[model samples]
Target: MNKKYIQCIGTFSIALPLLAAIILTGITSIVKAHLLGNFAESKNTYKTEQAQIAVLNELKIQHSKKQTQLKQWNQLLTGDSFTKVNERLRQSIADSNKTKTLQLTDAKRSTRPTYAVNAPRSACEFKLEGTFSEMQRCLTKLECRMPNLMINTMSLNSQINSNLLNLKLNYTIWENAQ
Candidate 1:
């Protein structure tokens, strides 16, 4: 009876330790899985935020570029009076005719509605006879010399019996409101 009692005690001690070890291992596995899930979720959130930041940065760069372009255009605009602008326009036309391949047949000017509260607008229509190359050269010269002039429309028609092309050009200019 004494020996049997000792054997039973030994078996109980070993089994108790084994059971406790198994429970501890299960708890540790569950905790490890939970931690891994949380880590993965955090990584995804970080990536999403980084992508949004990149997009916002790109937008800022584009805005800066647009602002610079606007500044350059504002500097290019002429602030001359209407009479001075007309004189300059006549001079530009004369200068373009140095090659003798272009001729201005008619020119008309009229007041146009203000495009902005601080800027007044005027329109000009020009009828010209020239070769295509000469007309293009004249247009380029005019635009370069008069930065405030914006070409609104243009039409070209080839003459029936001549090598010259008829050109009708319409443009607008902005002036200081004051």
Candidate 2:
């Protein structure tokens, strides 16, 4: 009886320690997986923020270019300067007309500014009846001549009974504020 009791006690001691070891291993594995998942999420977040910063820096550079262009377009708004700009615009139109045998039907010019900012702009609106190619060339020439010209709006419509297209062009040129 004494030997049997000793053997049973030895077996119980070994079995108890083995069961505790198995439970501890399972808990450790679960904790390790959770910690690794958090690390992966943090890494992804850091990368996304870095990309956004790069885009913002690029936008800042573009903003500086725009400011420099504005400075280069400063004007004193003299009568002679206005006449020159107007003559250049008319010459551009005439060249386009000669290129494609088209004519300007109606034209309007206004010194009223669309934006009431530190720099004011004069606007001209032209209505032309011609083929699409002719009107496109006209616009290209005007843009080339006046690099500071802003195309505020443009609309094209096909004439009711003819193959010709009706083009409306609204353009603005900036002037310095004194």
Scored by lDDT, the top model is 1
Candidate 2: worst 10 consecutive residues by lDDT?
Answer: 72-81
Off by over 4 Å in 2: 1-86, 98-100, 111-113
lDDT of 2 by residue, 26-113 (tens): 9999998999899899899989999999999999999898986655444324343445555765676687775455667767785555
- lDDT of every model, 2 decimals: 0.76, 0.73
Question: How many clashes would you count in candidate 2?
Answer: 0
In order of appearance, the predictions have TM-scores of 0.48, 0.48
lDDT of 2 at 162: 82
